[model samples]
Target: MTEHKPEKKVCVFCGSSFGVDPNFSKSASELGVLLSNNNYGLVYGGGTTGLMGCVAKAVASNGSYVHGIIPEALVSKERKNLDEIKKMNEELKESVENHRGATPLDDSYGKTTIVPDMHTRKRMMAQEADGFVAMPGGFGTLEEVMEITTWSQLGIHAKPIVLFNIDHFYDEFIGFLGNCVAKGFISPENGTIISVATTPEEVISKLQSYKVPEGRFNLSWKNQ
Candidate 1:
């Protein structure tokens, strides 16, 4: 039997923590609500903490389908009870529970698949998404987005890769990509493939306007 697929699924890489800036969580929640309203299924690391938890909870609250792929090693370890934030806002308790996937908190919010490792989790998410969104995050987030971008550069897939540069969160990383081009590591033409967005609308716009590279998947430098 064929697998059932949604019209569009976006794999989002974001911080497991909310970060120091309030804008991060705000943007994440907004993006989640907006994506769901636009009928896009959300795929991400299954952590109910930080910005990851914020986005997932918002998506769930807005009545959208959200799927999570997390490594079994991190499931029990990462999805900690965020008591500090929970106490700050009484209403957030419900959101927290929803992310926890606790009984009575589950409401067609979608499924969570616990994989064997991080590699498996990422592969599953990539397989499920038509596009990728990277929010402000630390090392893990950067790693996820860059891997997808590298895959695209090599023509592994034609899916859109975007940076949700909320509050200019990704400015330095964007510059780093340019630096790679300057250093002759990445092609200038290939660098244009990355779409940077400041808002949710821009994220969709970039995805809609994404173009596939002309050449097929390959690596010239490695062979030489």
Candidate 2:
């Protein structure tokens, strides 16, 4: 009898806003399409705005499932586009009304499944995903990526961390990693935890090539 392997789910972290570059949005949409076509589910911040919405909508439009975890307090603050939110609300309302029985207009749009904050979101993403992919984003994206990388570094996780370095957005960050190695913050040998690629295809390929070691590393800071 042949063994069946479990399907892998990838967690993607990106900006709620499209940023200054159009390339960022293009790359995100491309990733969403690729993930859907490949039968991979998406887990991301729940926002019907900016690149987050673009990716989620693209995947959903392709009939793929997406899991969104968002913090309640930042729903308005982190929202990318107010206009898009209203549109999504209307669509969601219609879908619900068609499938389910009629509901109150106030309750038309379902409540967001919100986490406490960014920290909670990061933990959830790491716990739920087989691996992580970071798209072009701002501080929030960086924080999520760094936390995932740290988890791997501390031997808490063995998942691959891939950086979609589209449009050379992460060039300076990559250079800073080199500086970390030089300053003894991170060993050059252990730097393989992060894989950099210019496109979604390359990102998936790089992640697939990663193999967790049979024995985990001792990650005690005191010992180090």
Question: How accurate locally, in lDDT, is each candidate?
Answer: 0.74, 0.68
Candidate 2 residue pairs in clash (backbone atoms < 3 Å): none
| Residue-wise C-alpha lDDT for candidate 1, range 1-224, written one tens digit per residue | 12234479889899877788998999898988888777787898866677887787777777777787756454333334435423452211223222334322233445566567888989889888999999998889999998998888776677998899999888888999899989998777887777899998898789888887654356554421
Report how far residue 34 has shifted in candidate 2, in Å: 0.8
- Clash pairs (backbone) in predicted model 1: none
Q: Per-residue lDDT for 11-107 in model 2, tens only?
A: 8888767778888888888888787777777777766556776777666666666666654445434344435645553222111111122211112
Show where candidate 1 strays beyond 4 Å.
1-6, 77-109, 215-224
Q: Judged by lDDT against the true structure, how good is candidate 1?
A: 0.74
Worst 10 residues of 1 by lDDT: 89-98
